[model samples]
Target: MKLFVNSLSFLLNVSVVALVVGGATGLAIIRDHQERLPSIEPLLDYRPSVRSLVEDSEGSPLLSLGKERRDLVSLDEIPEHLINAFIAAEDKNFWDHEGYDALAITRAAVRNFGAGGVKSGASTITQQLVKNVVLTTERSIERKIQEALLAFEIEKHLSKDEILERYLNEIYLGRGAYGVSRAAEIYFGKSLSDLTLSENAFLAGLPKAPTRYGLDIEQGKGRQSYVLSRMSLENMISEEEYAHALAAPLLISEGDNDTEQDQASHFVRSALTEVESIVEDAGDALAEGYVVRITQDSDLQGALEKSLREALIAYEYRQSAWKGPYKEDLPPVDSWTATPVLMDGDSYFVSINGEPLPLSKDSVKFANRGEFTLAPGMRVLVEKVGDKAKIRQVPDVQGAAVAMDPKTGRVLAMTGSFTQDGQFFNRAMDAHRQPGSLLKPFIYAQALEDGWSPTSPILDTGVAIQSNGQNEVWRPRDHNFSKSGFVTLRSGLEYSRNSVTLRLAEAIGEEKIGNLFEGMGIHKKAEPGLSIALGSQESTLLDLVSAYAALANDGVPKRPVMVESVSSKDGTVVYEPEDFIDEREPFFDEVTLAQIRSMMAGVTEYGTAWRAFEGAGYTVHGKTGTTNQARDTWFIGFTQNLVVGAFVGFDAPEPLGRGESGGSTAAPIVRAFFDQIDETYRISDYQLPDGAKIIEIDPDTGIPFDGGFKEIIRED
Candidate 1:
């Protein structure tokens, strides 16, 4: 019995020693791993005495999209009142506690656990800060453990001020912001340095429940008064101060606190998407705060948006007036409006005008359903009456506008329609509708390239020719349905003689014309025959704008660029538009371009687009095309700075009444854009490069003539 007792005691002693050894070994391993772990760097690095631009050169943030975020502020930069208010409302013994107060934590644990739900967190300011910075904003036991561990480490490493600063900057104050300074700016439109005690308390109260406090809505309800009372009750503020702060009215400044993307929301969204695609191609994440500086003037966007809304309203009113009666015998009257997209030939700063309704979200959803039913004429309903209001049974239709840079193919401004209520279907980039005589420029360009001088005799008299592979003889005619006598190539183009264009196409060969268009980035196959000469090739607004921009640039096509540059939060250039070089070769020779320009010059001076030049003070040179049966109408042209294209027609084929020519229907909208261009945008001059040689030539031919023809420049 004595031996057994001794053996048992020895076994117990050995077990205790073994357990201690195991624990010691595990602790040493954990400590080593902790020491080896890397420390997280601060969100933003401060460069020594270097100027950091919070906004772009245009005095707007590189990305002021969505709801404006508040500025980032430190605890020291914040007023004492704000800090006191926050401590009084959130955790009263915040300064005295070492990560947590035993008494307070115990009481909170009892109260929360008794309810069988997490009513209150037994968290100190340090713990909250740890959770915000290290752990995610999730309420769970595992996350709480992480937060506790991090808080204990932070308490050991950081001083009270440093911890407080981190907490102030890391806390989310709602309204798409994550900092106190940003909260103040979003709420009051001022910096933390400018905040008063009332303002400070208002912002300080927001960290608990920002949305519930109505801070996002900027509704200064009695929530401020409630916070002030809490501060007084906690002895953090004097009675007099609390009363004074409560009496103070909310003073929010209406300063230069506007969005860089306010008017250009549609354009900015597209540009951002494009930039994101480029970044993804490079295997980078877009969520890493990419600063995109777009080539958009906020002022121009505002003007365009304003003008579009107003025009839509006017059109709606006119439609409302026409509701009285329907007269069948009355002569048909075509009512149409043009939406022009103008972009810089060099830079892709796009400006757009005119307004067309867009497809509704409900309609899109209805179309997506596999099976559905609706009342007769139900589709025509749902016209916008005002912001967020709609009028039923109105003929609401979808249309789009687009503009791009001629040099780099960068899209500048694109408003799919007046009511931007759905995803953008940029008519300029999509929608391949046949452009009538507007495509004649390409044929004339081909004629010049194929050794046909501008003075070459082209018969304008009608002739039948086989079209496509159908062996169908198609005879194309002019607008007047008549033939002109023998005319120079330039004169034939100016007059838009269909027979002459057909003869020119025949001279160049159909396959050659198609190849030339393809070189200009037009992908559609040009059908063989006379109609191809009269703009029978179905092309999109983007295709036409790009082709015209080539002419405006003296034959150097620049791809449009909306986003100029994108940088990281550290100001390192992540993606730059200037870095990617375009490989598409120039489509037109300088001499041919010069001749084409002269012929198009006649469009504004003597042909279809004459009214576009006279009425609106626009330096516009373009051609108008009204397709047969009025299915599509187009006015593609360019100013000295930007190339613009406008198209107006029905989505489905229908006669758009009588006299729906591009000039009469679409030119006025183009004119309206130029008339207001200077009021809303900075005026830029157009210039030819150093080697462009200006020479006089007969309007009928590309050949140089002494004391005859118009001034034409041959870029060398």
Candidate 2:
């Protein structure tokens, strides 16, 4: 019996030894395979280049804000208080951890296993950084092993400071902001250096979930209070401190002069758009780190704003009742607004304004905030709403103003209303109304291009042009309901003879006429009809500005561009515009433009636009146009240095209280802008070429029967 038991024990021992050896062999094979495969250490220290679109200097995110999902800034650059707050709220021991906090992870794991489901992840900053930077947030044992390996690898290479910096910056802080600096600006209306402890705590609490903590502007104090409560619960601040901060008014910085003058919005908007393109080209990660420098002249912008405000006020009170040569109705104008633009002709640094009128929607909104009033000289409001503007209501006013450099077509200033607080409907770019006599210059220009001089005879006996398969009898007439049978072309244009314009349009041919306007940057489609010369077609302010600039540039047209260049934060060039040496197509011959310019100069000097020309010490040349019922008024003109256009009218196309001709309502604003300019630059005539000759002819008779005609210039 003893030998039998011993034999059983021996066999059991042998079986155990065999099983142990087999397990050892399998473990050795697994180890060898692991050695052959590349170690997971390389996966840990990942750094993605966060892309940022170019933005204006004011730091307003120019691109669609919520698109790019990064804000990588150095951790040390963030306020220490912010770091402390974040640590207290999230992982108390983010430092001194390899990849995971054992205590927290174990506790979470046990609870999750017992619950038979994956609960919340007990992720430290490093762990979260590993997941975000290296591996996507996915659930699997393989992925977990990969994450753990990567985190350990991260610990091997990057120092704690560099790792933490990457983690903090790459984390989403809500409101389309990626870093502490942007969050500080977006939330507190202050900088990172300026964050108070309370502000830091509020921002620190956001990394866990930005949307829940982000203060909605519409909710006002309620959202703020909720954020403060979260901070207190996280032990970032005492209850008393939380209550105090909640009660504290929003911390609006004193010197946020960035947008106080409306100086940077234009530049910032351009930068953001430019950066967006760069990012699209370079991919998001690389583009986010791009830093752009813009040619924004803030001082010039402020001056423009001030001058526009003063000019609008002066016009409202003084020239409110003025009339033009084409109108019988005089003013006691119901409402009026005007804009003026100043441009550096060489570089395209343009500044412009459309000062607010009392009845505008923007004014009403301002009145609600107690910033604007029904009368002039109202006090300004300077306050901040969280992540948005706390502006007064946009006024009911209908007007727009724009300014640009004639040489490059870069817009200097663009405003829809006189008041920055008023309606933002950029009349200059948005509205595409008929230009009335504004089309006469183009007609005369086309005639010149067709080998006819401004002195050519065009009998202004109302003629109906019927051609192009679409026209009925279209009898074009003069503004004053009178016709001169044999008026010289120069006299007819100076007097804005509409009958003469229609006659010239027929001579030039509608197809050729349409092509002329298109070449000059007019984008609106011209109907195949006689009224095409009477400015019956619609056009934007931008179109008119570019077209006029083409004329000012001796018929050489250049497409408008705002940004000059862009670069990465490391100073690597991302984008630089090819020299302004673009193709210059001839919209009209130099001599033709010269002749038309001379005729328009007459309109300013002794004809319709004299009001804008006479009072100003500098030489100004422009044409005035008034549509029927005074629905639209325009003044398009330029000096030797700048070309600016102004339009004024009601929003609903109502008759803008009688006598609101382009000269009376729009020209005066141009005068105001030029008067401001004469104080700065040397204003002179649009120099006529040497070969151009000025000939006197009869005003009433087309024949050179007597030199009783005005001095009409013919340029060859």
Candidate 3:
């Protein structure tokens, strides 16, 4: 018996030694892995990514778009009822536990042991914070060990409130919402403070399995009931509150139910872009939370959108052509007779009882065109509009429009692109297309400042100019290559006489012309060439309108602006419109302004744009521009108060057909835009300056024939 006892003791000692060695190895490995974990220093000053809001001047929300739709909030901002509800649902002993709940873990372990699988995680909110912020949610013994150890470490550094705040802001609540603040908005369309007991319970129940809960609305409500029952059982909420929460209906937002998006996607995009250029640190605007105040007037914006859309659709209708009908026979029509009139795969017809009639292009009207190439088995969308079927396809043609308060330099409305993705490109300010004849007024104004009068005669005959002094010469001529031998300076601009403009550029030194173009910010350091006088220099629509705004503003150039101010989430003004003001001295003198205004008025009244604004009761002053090959057509019209312009053309810079002109295309768009807002917008008339007199001139000869004024035709 003594010998057997000795052998057993020896075996026990050997086993003890082996177990100690194995345990030491495991501890060393775990220590190494723990050391390799990410540092938690970033959480010390965490700033959740918040959606940057674009607001109108009156502090109304216009847009709130971002990558992660988060709205960071402080622990104090969250209500006590919400906090207690989360605690009951997630970890009932949250306030009393030191980084972890021992009793809860024991119970979860017993439950899992009985189920023979991993069923529950008794992770405290502190542990969840470490998991979300500093570590991944990897399901492994090692990861859980690491999470628990990190939880203890985090609790030592951050207070209870800090951990809760970070957890609330960093938790992913599904539906692209990253935190409680945005979750309230996404699920209920309410602010944090505005949430009811029922709303709070619904949000609190989403932390564990947001995606699963989001999939089944009833399942999500069941989770909310569980949270509510737990809250009531824990005495976190009264029975009455729980009853009301259970009774309240779940009102969730249809992801992307952001009303601001529906308000003005195009303008919001423009404002966001402008915000980027102005805001130095992107975090200051989005991550740190800011409200960007833009100069948008909703009424004007609607009008601009309506006018641009209708005009583009109309243009597309005129330009559309049926590539070919579907190869298969079309369905039977009610009244039409179609007895298979096709012979050589040229056409198809519906069967009818009457005569065998062939289908003609004009027999039935095409409601939509210029978008698709009709082919066999094509699924055509047909909508009956009175007696015609109207289909929808985005046309190949694109356009842009802009409206501004000329005096204040505030951009009221802007529609950048007409395509479905209107925000893809800011055609109003970014597209630097050739201004064409719209540039004539500035050149004429420069001439008048240089001792030239309205009657100063310039030869409008053809002129040949050298290109880089090479053998290739540029023969500047009219739109139709039609030339008038000689014309007055006034007539030169009023008619957009390209030949006359080239002659004036030659008369005025090329260096001064270069200065004039560059100084106005039209084109940068333009090459010394007369071609610039013919609108060869590419300028954004906004820059051209701003130049005309100078003419309307009696010389002071007020640069166009979109964002009026930027404020912090706390409503502290960080950026003001005054900071962006480019209040430069008038680029043109009063006399130059008067002469140019007079000439532009003539252009609108009796020139290329005469028919567009013919009977416009109020005074209208503007010019028309049509680029070579009709690639771009523009019309910039303005009163003393407002400046509006638009450009219509293919995005690929192709011809928009032969007959399309600025007066026929873009002028009417601006006219349509003004017509909608005519009741709201009162265009102020241009007044003569002190010591200025009305000078009468013969329309045909540019000679002062009489002192009698024939309409608004006084030129200095």
Candidate 4:
């Protein structure tokens, strides 16, 4: 009996020794595996490809562009209930476990085996974080081992809160939202701090399947109820709170997924193009979370848009005889849907869907004297404003306007078209059209440099130039087709006399004028012909405005600055406006600029643009441009503080109408814009340069006269 007892003790002792040895060997293997895993230190500094933001000069976000939208939040900012909700839904034993949950994994294994598929994943928050950060979704045992090993290593280096924070931010929530903060905005249109218990539960339920749960509220409700039940069962939430949350209705706010997309779209597009030109690999830069600051004034932009639309509508109404929609032309009361086709002045052209409706005589009346053509599939809308039916065009006639700061060359307001929807072309900088008489100012500036004062007289008689190859003779005549005998240069420009301008160009040499035009900022090579003097060179509104701004800045040209600066996510300025002031020697003498400016003032005071600003209460130096047949009309004007340019024309060049000259057409729009300016911005007159002296001069020969009449001349 004693020998058997001793043998049993020895066997038990041997069993204990073997168990200890095996357990130690297993622990060493795990430690070695953990050591072999990649370090999670890089994850501590991990940053996702956040959306790039475009801001206005005032620091208001104008737009954001990217595939993923994320706003990072610290763990402290996360509410305790929010964290508890996620813990209950994803991992109840998250704090207790190092990297994984053994019991949950065993239960999931059995369930998956029973179902012959992956019914559930028992990954802890840390394990999930490791998978998202470093591992793929592959279900192989090798991948699972790697994931487990990485999670253990991560837990050793990072705290529970750190793991939770990273996991919350790295997970994808639907609608291009990647983090809780962004998801909060996407789902509720509110910040994370503003989320209610029900909203919190809804978000907590999304990690399982964000798309399925995010899109359908019914599906989300089921998962949300499960999450709330789990929270209650885990004591994370009181039973009363759980009940209240479960009873709460799911109210989803409208997602602003595309809100930043189309607002100020034309300006945004232009800014993006400019940014791309400066930053090579702009896509990568955007992904790295760059911020672009542009010089767009939202208030001014809104006003500019409204003014352009109103001006076009008013012009169309004046030109057209159609008062309103005809009763006979109207569709049946119910069948006539108030579909908006095109905006004509105050009326909208109405039509029924899928119906063929001819434009009534009322609608065609605005059509430029037999120049209106309506294509098939044209749409219109009609609405009752008061007692009359008003018709409007869907995509109204297009136009562009640009306002800039002459000192800094900053574009304060710009629009590519009257409406941002239909056409995507940016007319402000991209549309290269004939400047018409807008080029005349540069020619006159050249004349000033050549010692010709504003009162220099030129013959306004018929001038003929033989075509180089054709037998046709080009005889330039005034708009009135009558000669004025002789007129001062200022008078010639104010009246836009074609004959006077052509003769002056002949005497000064067109090539010299062309060189001066290039020096002033007209980028295109000047057209070779006597007609070039009549403003026939192709230039963009931006270039033309900048050139005029040079004159406003006293002969120093400033490159138009659309983007003020660009910064990266780390707040490093990547690009800034530098060397934009053209220092290639002064193109025009200060006295010449001052003299021309004074002469341009005549255009607004007593010339073609007179009626437009008769009682405007302030003086503006400006020039009016009317192309041949009035295809393009322009008004480039400036005060001491601002420079604004407006253009009206058809996309396909055609005569606007019989009397739609720049003075009568585009000048009125400019006047309407200035009328809206606050009194503080209004400047009564430009400060004359020191070298210039005002003296009484004879209007006929531009020679000094002792009479009371006064003119500005350079003291050479």
Q: Which candidate wins on lDDT?
A: 4
lDDT by candidate, in order shown: 0.56, 0.57, 0.69, 0.71
Where model 2 places Cα greater than 4 Å from the true spot, the runs are: 1-271, 274-300, 303-395, 421-424, 465-472, 481-484, 582-584, 678-682, 685-691, 696-716
Residues 569-625 of candidate 1: C-alpha lDDT, one tens digit per residue: 466765565544546655777677666776686777777778656644434667888
- Measured against the true structure, the TM-scores of the candidates, in listed sequence, are 0.52, 0.55, 0.61, 0.60
Task: Between candidates 1 and 2, name the one with more favorable lDDT.
Answer: 2
Report the C-alpha displacement of residue 335, candidate 1, in angstroms: 23
Ranking by TM-score: 3, 4, 2, 1
Report the lDDT tens digits of candidate 3 across residue range 132-159: 5565433443555466566766777888
Give Cα distance to truth, residue 609, candidate 2, Å.
1.4
Residue-level lDDT tens digits of model 4 in 46-106: 7665566888888898877555667889998877888888999999999998686666665
lDDT of model 1, residue 681: 25
Evaluate model 2: give its lDDT. Answer: 0.57
Which model is ahead, 1 or 4, in terms of lDDT?
4
Give RMSD to native, each candidate: 20.7, 18.5, 20.4, 19.5
Tens digits of per-residue lDDT for model 2, 1-716: 24522332233223221232343443443334323433433334445544444443343334333334444566657887677666666667777776656566556555655655444456677766776555544443234434444555567677778767776666655445566676677667776778876677667666554533442232334544565665667676787787778766665233322321113243344334443343322222222445554433344344445444444543343323211111223211112212211223321111112322223333234333433223323222211223221212122335555556777766555555555431324466667888888878778877777777666777767566676675476665565633545766777788898777877877778788877777666754567666767877888766887777776776765566556556654566646666576565677766777777777778887788886677555556678888887788888777555667777776788776655688877777667665654343335455556666666665555455454554545544
Superposition error at 238 for model 1 (Å): 70
Locate the minimum summed-lDDT window of 10 residues in model 1.
43-52
Residue 662 Cα positional deviation in candidate 1, in Å, after optimal superposition: 1.4
